[model samples]
Target chain A: MMPVGNLVGMVVRNTVRSPRHFALSAFGIVIGIASFVFFLGLSMGVRNVILGKIFPLEVVEVVAPRASFMGKDITKKLDDGTVEMIRARPEVKEATPRMKVAFPAAGFGMFEGQEIKFEVGGFCDGVDPKVLADDPKLAALFKDWEAAGADDPAKTVACVPPVVDDKGVAGKNPCPDPEFYYCDVQDNRCHRRVPVIVSPTLLELYNGQVASTHGLPVIGDLEQFVVERGGLARMRFTIALGETMVAGSAMATSDKKRRVEGMLIGITPKAMPIGMTVPIEYTRRWNQEFAGDEAASTYSSIVVTLNDKDRLAVFSAWLQEQDLRLEDQLGERFATAIFIVTTLFVLISFTIVTISSINIAHNFFMQVSERRREIGVLRAVGATRTDVKLIILGEAALIGVIGGLLGVGIAFAGAALVDWASATYLPRFPFKPPTYFDFKGWIIAGGLGFSTVFCVVGGYLPARKAAKLPPAQALAAQ
Target chain B: MSEAVIKLRDVKKSYGSGAARTPVLRGVSFEVARGELIALVGQSGSGKSTLLNIIGGLDTADAGDVEVLGHDIRKIGEKELAGLRNSSIGFVFQAFNLLDHLTCLGNVTLPASFTPGAKDVEARGLEALRRVGLVELAQRHPSELSGGQKQRVAIARALFGAPKLLLCDEPTGSLDSETGREVIEFFRELNEKDQMTLVIVTHERRVSSVARRIIAIRDGQLVDGEELALGAPGDAGGAGAGGPA
Candidate 1:
């Protein structure tokens, strides 16, 4: 066998001598690798938007099962005790209890001096502040402001109450800082505006569908809107307690409705899919005041975060035993569909690569036939059969490296083009990603490795054929 | 005689299968002493080239006790045979088989690549080119050189390993008579000054004329001159004889 350096030198020299042949032989590999990279990147990007935004996989929502008509009595209320029990389980990282505002409510907000009113009857939930811990800014702003003022009276700011007329209408006596304080009409007292969070999915839906349809300006950047633009102060709204637009007078607890202010703090995946989420203390207070103490203490559902998502099956089984069920079956179905599509794309890429390798084999066989005399000359000068084989395989590996790099570059260019086209021409849709492809480091490395391995595999038989050629016969070959 | 560098006894080789088989070398035997220059003269199909290939460890004999530099050619594995060929024997062919892509120096240094830890390979290659009087043309590719220059480059490559024996198969077959004569003279000079052992397999009279002894073959069997040269008791049959000088 020859020294590795010399062998490599010879292989490079031989390979470079015929660039046209190398390019033709490597074309199949380039196409195969490009397709492979493009498909994998696209799948990853789509999966990110689907799983990360539309239906997150980190936490599973567990709710009490409905009672059966046969009176099986399997329905267990989700409460503080149940939350503690779930949190104590080894598989559960956290169990955050969420309660729906049992009383009727409606919100009217002013944004840029334009009034927007919406019913909050089925669109409001309350959760613990710890649910927003992943985002420091959100966590800081989403605390129970009522509890904070109660804990320290110094945190409270005094405000004048709005004067009410005999017709059940009130004159505005807005608090100096509506973000943190509200003039409550019922108690004639100042209270903090309930810090609320909305889901990122809601923002996406509004931007992609609602805002476009209504010719409203979309919330372009979440960070800028929530942090840099005075956060909650920019989106202050009044929530009328014990009243709702859906059932006007019938659902009201009294003829005179109590009004408190609410503010949008931040958006997060932990928030309700189509609702405003406030700190649990505020909901508990409101539920107790308008409904009953039982409504305040019992939770509507619990969000269970797992330490390892792989242990979801065990956790789900435990939930089933507790007469609870996971509420995100749509997420599972989406995941399965995405997985099947990704696998099919991968299989098609693999088939292209496999066929390309056969092309490489055919090209190498022709090269060997053409270079019979060259092989004989090398053998005559002291190269062994193994040396010849190494030289040929080395050339194949070089071609693979070149082809792999080119393929990946082309895939990136293709992705950029697709993203550009989507941004420039395609209509906006919910959960549409900024780019349609994600070229992770592993995918690039795997693409290069896959190309090189297949090329070497293709060259093996031809290399063996070259090695087996008798030096004398090879020399005599024309 | 000086210790034999190559010894062959009852060597036999054939081509093709049973019914179609044609014998190429039949019970042929000879010894080449160290530092001796000899020629094996035969017609195209008489198997002189095949005999040379067997001696060089490039081809296996069907039956034989063949030894070169004291290593049994038949008993050793392919790797050992390759090592023997790489270090102890050199081959020169009629086509001046230089890799066309490489320069003269590159072609000459090709053999050193297979010899591990071969120090000063480039310097040694230059020296080999110097010995062949082609040092000035070291950077020239084979396609740019004359037929005689290419053959000299081939010779330089063959001498790169400083092999004990040089085997030439029609080394001047592609050259003009004048250039062929010059190459033959260079071989004679190498034999005389460097004490290099050489086996020339050729049908040309000029190549045979320069050798110290000539062994003629007919119908795949050695004729008279080899028996006389080896001092074996045998009848002097029809042969092309050229005894020591």
Candidate 2:
């Protein structure tokens, strides 16, 4: 057996001397590894957008089973009790009750200096403030204003209204705490606006579809627009409680109609898909005012956040026993589609690497044949058969390392080019990612490891043959 | 008499099997004393090289007792045989067998690579090159050197381990006569001054003339008198003495 240093020296010298012989072989490895890296990166990037942004898998929405015909209830009601029960499970990180506005409502708001009116029926829901706890900025702004004395007429103070000059331009309002309180012109009273959060999907829809069609300026970053920018960009809106566009849809009479101020806080995936989400306390108070105590307490749905997604099956089974079902069937289907597509791409890459390894084997066999006399000479100089084998394998390993690094680099460059093309040439669309490839560290390392193992495997048979060569016969060869 | 460095009794070897079997060394017996410089002279296909390979532990005898440097060649395992070949026997081949990719010094130190914990390999290689009077060409690759320089480098490599015996199989076969004469004189110097047991196998009378005694082989068997008078330089009378038995 040769010393490791001596073996490495010989292997390096031989490989460096005859690089052309291994170039073609290394090219095959590079192509195989590059394809593996590129395809895997693309898959991961698309999956991140789909599963992470559009339909997050971390939280599952649980809803009561639909009522049977003949006005009979079919399952247990989704309420605070159900939320508590769900939260008690070990897999449940959190279970927050969500309530839709039980009464008809209409919202009129000044967005970027333009007055806009929209119906809030079936679109608005309320969630616990704890949902935004992970984001301190959002959590700080989104809270129950009524619980903080906004609903008490005696607690309210006189507002310092904005001064209007002769040209009808209003100056900044003199309210001291403008972030949470606003000066209502009708009542001349400072009131805290109901803080609300909207889903990222809703923002994507508004920017990608609605804003473009309506010629309205799209909100770029919701947090920056609502929190960072001051004055009219603060997104103050008024909701006419108990009064909707459809006159007969109001559950309460005209005398019960009341207007409440609302403020846009930030965007979150946990928000309701199509509308603004406010604190559960606001919805409870309004539900009790316009409908009944039962409507106030009963939730529309419960969003269950799971600590371990691997135990989701068990959680889902428990939900079934509680007469509820997960509302993420579409997300599950999308995840399955992504998995199958990624697996197919990986299998295709594996096949390419396997074929390339065979090519490596063929090249090594030819090299061994050409260097028979050299092997014989080494054997004559006291090199064991194992030494000959190791020298050959070591050369193959060097080729693998070089080819693997080049392959990874090429894949990264290819991804950057694709991302540049997407950003430069492609039109904006809903959920379109900024980049289409995610080159994670493990993926690059795996590509290199895969190349080296395959190359070594390819060299095994040829190395064995070289090691088994008869020294006498090899020396006597012409 | 000096102790026998190499002892072989009734050594037999053959190639192939069945009707295709051809015996290369049949019942050949010989002893080479320590520090003795001898030659085995034979024509092509006369098995002189085969006998030398067995003596150097590069090949095994079909049925016989063979010993080199006090170790039984037939009884040792492949690893032990490789160790014996690496440390106890030095082989100088006709083709020089210098790796073209390596420098002259690199080729000289090739055998030392197999010795675990062996230090100062380059220095020892340089010393061996100095002995061969090619120290200045240590950095030159084998392809850059002339045929005679390459042969001297191969000899330096053969002497790297300071082995107990040196085996030469037509060592001067590839050189001009003058270069061949120089290599032969170097072999004589190694034997006389260094007391290295040397065995030179050759068909050329000039190469054999430098040896103290000659053993001629014919048709896989030694001649009646294994030891012959040392042939004088340029002697051509017994050039074809062992042809076809």
Candidate 3:
């Protein structure tokens, strides 16, 4: 064989001479390759975001009182009595009863005609400490809480984190109504005051405002959180009560702040677990006299943290066996939907790439036919069928590479746009957005490889035609 | 010591099938000696082109012996035939058939690119172009050249490989009478100076004069082959009985 360099030069010259045709043929292939890459990236990214990073790792099973869109008809409420029943079960490692106060939801403590809206504080019984040690993700946060106060470590006290809003905790806890504090006060309301662990999306909502107001440095201050449902709402004596508790915090980080209301709610890692509390006796005493909502007195939900995350399904199934209903709500369902969408995106992209490859093949076929005489002349002189095939296939591979790069660029831009959009909308809706960029490499590289193969396949028809052209007739075509 | 470059005995060819299977070449017998310049001339539908194609290894004969350079074309497969065509012979067509994409130099270098150990094909290509007085136009593409220039490029391409025989199929049909005459003179020079075997299939009176031997075909059979004198001979132009079947 002659030097590959010479052959390459000839191919380049031939392709360049008819630049219009060459460009047209490769255009479809390039676009196809790009689409494949983009789709793959997005799918992989979605998978990573949804599954790779989520909080409240230990508190796997949550018993909520509220009926979701796909409501499960539960026969009874999981109050203090139900928590005791769950504790008696063999599969249940540690069952803690938590409650959500409705009187606070109706209205918070008002001072000097300035009424403060009370956040639905999640209250839980003190954890056995062994449960925290069993789960790694929970152990870190438990250690952080323990470090906050080692002396009388509020082991069974209710801890509320301050709402780190856009203006950073807005005010100091020096006054009685700290929630309505002004922006100028440099206080510990954001960090030490409340131990607020928000969603990554919601974090932007506060925009480090809580950090500055809390008089604490923002670095290493943030925490991971998860929220699980508070068990059933029950009406007792003319009061419709819904009491949910945020678990996983021993005591509020600061001494001045008794309780703080986080703006966002629902079952997420950012929301506290259903187990951590100031002790059930203290919760009954706080709600019975301080607030008139009678139903808030009982344990509305029993939060069960198992020995292993994999055992969650077994525990949940056991709960069902005991006639206790387990329902996954709209938010968790929405995460599952993300996976489906990513799968569809991949399929659609592959289809587009396939079509583009076909288009490239058609273009090459026509080109070979048009250049039959040239092919024959080459053959007559000394070009082998292999040489002709190489030129065609080489062109296709080039198209795939160029297209793949372009597609990756497009995918990056798309991911950025999605991130921007989520940042803008997540806090307002009070739901955390999953992280991005997890599956990028697989999508981009795999897409490129797939697209290149498609392009090469497209080149097959034209290559065969070029090889099959009779030197006699092809030469005689002139 | 007079080895035959091409040998054919009772070679036959047909097209289609059943009643439609029209036999093109029937029982043709011939031999082309090494370094022999012989012109095979015939009218339209004389099957001269078919015979030429068989000899060039571009088409296969149905029956009988057909050999070129010690390889039997009838028995050998398409691959060997193609190899034979590429290494042993060169062709010049009526239309000049130059690739539009390649320059005159690129065109001439194409054939030798196929042959093994033909590494310095480009230099030989340039030499061939120089011989045709188109060395300066080597970079110019075929479309950039005139009809006469294109044909000259084709001639250069044929000579670049240094094949045993240069096959011409009405090589001057597309050019004017003057350019055609000039092309014939170049063939004469090639035959006389380099002893290049030049087979020109033509109907032109002046074209045949360049060749020492002229063979005429009527239908598929060879009817006449005679030595031509330097000056005008008796009925040399239409002396053969070969015409349209």
Which candidate comes out best when scored by DockQ? 1
- Residue-wise lDDT of candidate 1 within B1-245, one digit each (tens)? 67888888889999999899999999888888888888888889898999999999878899979999999999988778778878888889999989988999999998887888889989999999999999999999999999999999999999999988999999999999999999999888888788899999999988877776777787778875253342211324423223331
CA shift of B50, model 1, Å: 0.5
C-alpha lDDT (0 to 100) for residue A16 of candidate 2: 91
The C-alpha TM-scores of every prediction are 0.93, 0.92, 0.66
User: Each candidate's lDDT (Cα)?
Assistant: 0.84, 0.85, 0.61
How far off is model 3, as Cα RMSD?
10.7
Please report the candidate that would top TM-score against the real structure. 1
Question: Compared with the true structure, what per-residue lDDT tens digits does model 1 show for residues A362-472?
Answer: 999999999999998878877889999999999988889889999999999999999999999998787777897888999999999999999999999999999999988
| Residue range A1-478, candidate 3, lDDT tens digits | 4347666677667666776875776666566655556555655565444443343233444565354455755435566677777777666677766554423212143222233332344423322233335446534333223233543223333324335578443222343333322111223332212122233433433335543554533222232221111211000001112322233333323132223222221112423332122223334544664454454545555667556555556777677776665445333454457757867776777777778778888888888888887777776666666766777776766666666666666666777777787777765321244544544556667867886788788888888888777667777663
lDDT of 3 at A271: 33
Q: What does each candidate score in C-alpha RMSD?
A: 3.7, 4.0, 10.7
Once superposed on the true structure, which residue ranges of model 1 sit more than 4 Å away at CA?
Answer: A70-74, A148-159, A164-178, A222-231, A248-257, B224-245
Error of 2 at A209 (Å): 1.1
For candidate 2, list the clashing residue pairs, or say none: none
Q: In candidate 3 chain B, what residue range of length 10 has the lowest lDDT sum?
A: B225-234
Q: What lDDT does candidate 2 reach at residue B150?
A: 90
> Model 1 lDDT vs. the true structure?
0.84
Q: Stretches of candidate 2 above 4 Å error?
A: A148-154, A158-179, A182-189, A226-229, A246-255, B229-245
